[model samples]
Target: MKQFLILISFLFVYYSTAGIEQAPPNFKVRDKQAVFVDFRRAQYNITFDVQNHRALVETKILFEQKQKGYPLFDLVNRPLSVTIHDKEVEVSLIKTPGDASKLRMIEKELPKGIHQVIIHSEIENGTRFSTNDRKPDWGNVSSGFFIRDLRDRMFLEKYLPTNYEYDQYRMEIDVKVTGTKRWHSLFTNGEKTKVSENHYRVRYPDFYTASSLYFHLVPINRFVRYYLTYPSIDGRDIPVTIYSNYRFYNYLAKKKAWKVMRELEADYGAYPHDQLIIYGTGLRGGMEHAGATETSIVSLGHELFHFYFAKGVHPANGNSGWLDEALASWRDKGYQTVDLPFYDSANLAAHNLYTRKTDKRSYEYGRSFMGYLDKQLKEIGKPGLKDFLRVFFAKRKLTTVTTEDFKSDLEEYAQMSFQADFFQYIYGGHMPPESGHKHVDHDHGGEENPHHPARTEAEMLSIL
Candidate 1:
């Protein structure tokens, strides 16, 4: 009995540590900024002063140098000070390949092995507050911060020092809001502990990437919040929170969220996150932020579906982003299957290394491509794409994936080669023609995709 117990303990420890030792599929040695160091953990201490309309942040990062190379991290906001290995270091800005914006690069080269760095910075709070409107002006903030880094170059680096999406690391945040009499509420996907009024400590899982965080802070009175517990099929009673500025959406949002959760769990195996948070904007579109989403009433299902694909099985880069969007859009359109061959020519997954924007065509054209693939899969005496997605999610949840990884997995499941189809449809921009259908013309620019239009910075300042 004693020997058997010891063996079980040894196996548990081995399996737990094995995942940490293996790098994620997204970690590429060719990525210029990420090649030098391996990010392991990050801790951020943030303080918001509502009266002054300013935010102060201190970040401590733990990383290891793979070789003797300079280290760099992305941060749009300039830092007031930086320290490496407990020594003050000078930093400079340099542009990486395909990225117009520059990253903060450490001045000195570091030898191989682990290292620690600290950074302090300040940002003028973009959210504004006004007392003149009784309609609950979106611009008026009692005191808070909202962060959603969905677009290219808009990761956590926009406000604090952080690594790129290719790196997965644990994150801890200490948030304190002051200079306001109104109460504030915190919304996040991480494990949250309320230390006191207006103070919180959040810790994220180690498997999270740069894009996996969704942090929102707002005044309690500014919005209506509803809470419920979902009895998940996996036996975890998941907590659900829905909030909106409008009072009328409280009941409707809760109902719709419940329905969406049920449908997603039925299609997939289970809800991947510990909790589900929704912010019904009552607008046209929405953004999927890990387990939390700021979405419109109509787009709620689409965004929630993302928690399983886009957020749960994360995209490693902009180039591979179409898979999740296409999958969600396909599901939204009732999972239609088409026998007609698609002649469309769009390189939805062809982007440079530093490019950070998902192709806009992933919504319209990408959905059609999925339908075509589903039809093909069914015709080959195999289960439909839906079944494959369920299996894929079960296998790949909590990990980052590339388009190639997705294709390889699909091929392995179907026991067939999809190389020609992917090369023509996704990468090479040439699809077999379908009779009687006119080829649609599309602008192939790398700018923000119009399908999932997000609020402008000015609009976000007003709304957040």
Candidate 2:
């Protein structure tokens, strides 16, 4: 009996301690900091079973180990199974500290090299899209059925097992979806290739891995689709399409879009993508995506302009949201000649750029800061926003830009220092001095130094 107990202890020590020693030296993790891996790409095959209120999904991810250590994948919800390097492995789904979403990481140690991982899971089609009667409408305000609606909705959480919001994994993807017989139409960001009657494939060369995969699955009766070609400045035909419910609204929206596209082309060279698709939503305003945008007539111009600033040259990460927002709001000519209200001591530079909570400040302060850029450009006797955009887009299109990168570009273009302006107005969160007001003199290139007028709250309300 004593010999049996001694044998069990000896085996435990061998398997726990000596077994780990047999791993590669890089895998001998002393602490969490030693783990370093770069996620490369992810591929997804999904079967959307709306009738069953669930989806069966399989995802494969490719990653490279920068050093000898384990890599962690930000996976939300429970997964049926997780595998590393083609082998099923045990994984812990501990709640990540300081996160409210109950997100967990699938962590595994690996040797220093490239590897492929897979996750298979079944997800519930939650009641987020259900009506009071318990019928799923998918936000079909137009009386349509859409599987992946982007009406301020999050399909990523339900369908994808991914990392946290800030860790953006930019990668190419090949996606296939089946079981769409009930839906009338489906629209995705990639080029559509039909495989079977109800099965389809979409291919993306470089998808914004960190962002949500937006899909619009709508009933046929809800949308009016059309195609038209506009002449580019370089004499090439640009194919444009619009999907919406109202014919009159689509007509007017197309007109505005064409004008904006032309203006953007002239300023920023050619549009980067092969074609542009605009999806109309019952929801007010719009959101931008690569090669496409979702919008309404009220915000057609603003959202369309994002193709150049936001989608064309994406902001580097969450902390750089102001870069694109500032440019987009600046391009929004609707705000140029109005009663430009002042921010209530709110500055965009000092604000955390990641969360959606800062959107209001990002727009208000970002627009004001961009206005400051116009002032600086004019001070050097240079043409203002248009010329600056021409240069910026030429240099940074189809890429990501950081705040520091934008500042450097502005400094280079103006041929004057912007160190103080960046620090005070952007980094320090200080409102621009009164000198940046529209009332400042420009005809004689001289400053009036006049006291700026402050309207009463009632006047502000009336103007708004």
The local distance difference test score of each candidate is 0.71, 0.52
lDDT top scorer:
1
For each candidate in turn, give its C-alpha RMSD to the true structure in angstroms: 7.4, 13.1
Query: Can you write out model 2's per-residue Cα lDDT over 1-464, one digit (the tens) per residue?
Result: 64354345334322211111111112222354234244445667766554444556788766555565556554445778888756787555443222212333446667776566788876443311212235443322111112121111132554466542333343333333333333345566666776653456765544243343445544446577878887877777867778777777679878888888887787678877666777775455556666676666777777667777766675544335556666677666443522223433333443322121123345556677777667666667998856887888888766655566787788888887777766665555442222222211111111111111122323222211
Question: Candidate 1 local accuracy as lDDT?
Answer: 0.71
In model 2, which regions exceed 4 Å deviation?
1-31, 34-37, 90-104, 123-158, 161-184, 220-222, 334-359, 429-464
Model 2, TM vs. native? 0.71
lDDT of 1 at 240: 88
Please report the candidate that would top TM-score against the real structure. 1
